[model samples]
Target: MTDRSPRASRAGLILVPLLLLAALTACGSENDPSPVAPTAASSSSDPADDTAATEPPADAEPAVTLVDPWVAAAPQGVTEAYGVLVNRSTQARTLVSVSSDVTDVVELHETVVVEGGQMLRPVDGLEVPPQDGLALLPGEDGITLVNVERPLEDGDEVALTLTFDDGSSLDVVAPVRG
Candidate 1:
């Protein structure tokens, strides 16, 4: 019985060290910034990965940036697009025209109060001040898409081209939402 007790104590000593080593190895240090393994959807070989492609080039800085452009869902007749136009340049810029593939006519419009009712009035252009921005919002100020060829539903995507007064144009895809 005495010999058996010594053997059991030695076994326990060996097992304890092994368990401690395993626990230390499993816990990684916080300072290590190891890259995680990419999932199947975000793999490099997937052609749908547009994160790198959509980024603007480092050498070129655009004067104007359209933020969160979206189109409102409406019936077959007409809808509107809204977004924020941010101007980074020192000179003012004007939105000259807007065209969309889903609509034959696109017009800039502003809401006005007439006879205690609100109405959308057509406007020639929308201006963005120097080093400032403009928000094309709903109900009051927005771009109206006239003669829509098809009915717009929520989650539909529409392609639009916005032309500026300086002959510069920007192509954007606006998502339709209610």
Candidate 2:
């Protein structure tokens, strides 16, 4: 297990990208200039719906965005992806599954504090709150790639697609490091 957050990636090729992410997150974007949430449509008094949100208008922003996405380096076996999942839309989204280019099996996992220590358990889905988000941190909630086909090394990248319950999906390239 590895700490994939930028705070833990303090060395090697990983630090450059993680530090940039930290700086950008700390500084904030120039165009929108909101807090963690982006500047998008506000909540409306409509019945809760997730299907219709499958596709957004060309001008519309993404319902969810991954901030500083990254993974821990590993020669093989399992590795977890970490990032802040920010849901910009008013409706909540559930991350049902994850597909990876390097691994055939990617499962959603949640870390729970047991009597002895901590344990990683498989979960059906990870929910992202409306106009809020969820953090995929190591030893916590995240997606795990089982039996990676190739070595995941520092500065390498892994392509992942996050499919939501609403039929929406987001493609991300997460950096590999320690």
Candidate 3:
């Protein structure tokens, strides 16, 4: 005699519709057809969707520009340079950093008053507004590049890359001026 348990019978009953549904889903329907919509889980895995999701943001500012870059000529073993960082952007921007390959250290420095006397101090950074400029004037008790580590001869050139607040960069060739 064949023995059939209640659980086995119930399992067989549930399995029939599941297999039928799988077969029907696997086959594409033609008549009374509706466009299939992608499930959210599979939709995001698409290559096109991944690209669109990773694309850079729009309304990003155009490239930044630097104008009239020049540095004062110095004697041998001179490591400091001074010039103007002019922002040619139509929008205001703050210079977050400056760097050069000619010097061991590059910084945005300013001269300010301190206890009992004036002092030349290094600034965290500098700001240059739209259509404006930041002056790096080296003078007595005034803002200047301190303790330069490289020799800047006349006609020598160095590239200064300025970073703006808007995640853009500009490279300017600042020549050593006489």
Candidate 4:
């Protein structure tokens, strides 16, 4: 009879590699875990839960919202715009500059008591606090729109662009009011 022991040993050596290869291939198959489904307690059908999901996170980007923006009616020469700058973000922002098609020059101004007289002075920028607001009124403390192209009449809409230090800008068509 032929010596079968050596042949069997050789066959076993080949089968060992095949078995290891099968084991490795099995492990390499896609076995990603399924996403967890929302439970009844966390479902958004509840109004409170829906609101929580829609709210921005604590570290979300700063959101600057302009509310009730209006330009004062000017018979001639210069005037100013008024509004509430609401900052909903966690970080403070700066109002860098302002522009408008109705005027050639727009600048940020603040009122200061100088020698017991309140005067308007140009400021580089205005800081808007986080979760707070800044009011731009028609006074020495408000922003000044200089050299208006024409007299802004009541009920007219003027396009105003506000620039922030973060390179973001807001364009608003503010209504002209007294």
| Model 4 lowest lDDT segment of ten | 27-36
lDDT of 1 by residue, 40-154 (tens): 6656775677664455444443566676799999878888898877675568999989999898899998788889888998988888776566677666567999899788999
**Least accurate 10 contiguous residues by lDDT in model 1:** 25-34
Please give the lDDT score for candidate 4: 0.72
Instruction: Give the per-residue lDDT of model 4 (tens digit) for 26-104.
Output: 5432221123465777675767677645554444333675767888999878898887776655579899998988877
- Each candidate: how many clashes? 0, 0, 5, 0
TM-score of each: 0.65, 0.69, 0.51, 0.64
Among all windows of 10 consecutive residues in model 2, the one with the lowest summed lDDT is: 9-18
RMSD of every prediction = 23.6, 9.3, 28.8, 29.6
* Segments in model 3 whose C-alpha atoms lie over 4 Å from true places: 1-64, 76-79, 88-91, 114-118, 140-150
Q: Which residue segments of model 1 deviate by more than 4 Å?
A: 1-59
Better of 1 and 3 by lDDT: 1
Query: How much does candidate 4 score in TM-score?
Result: 0.64
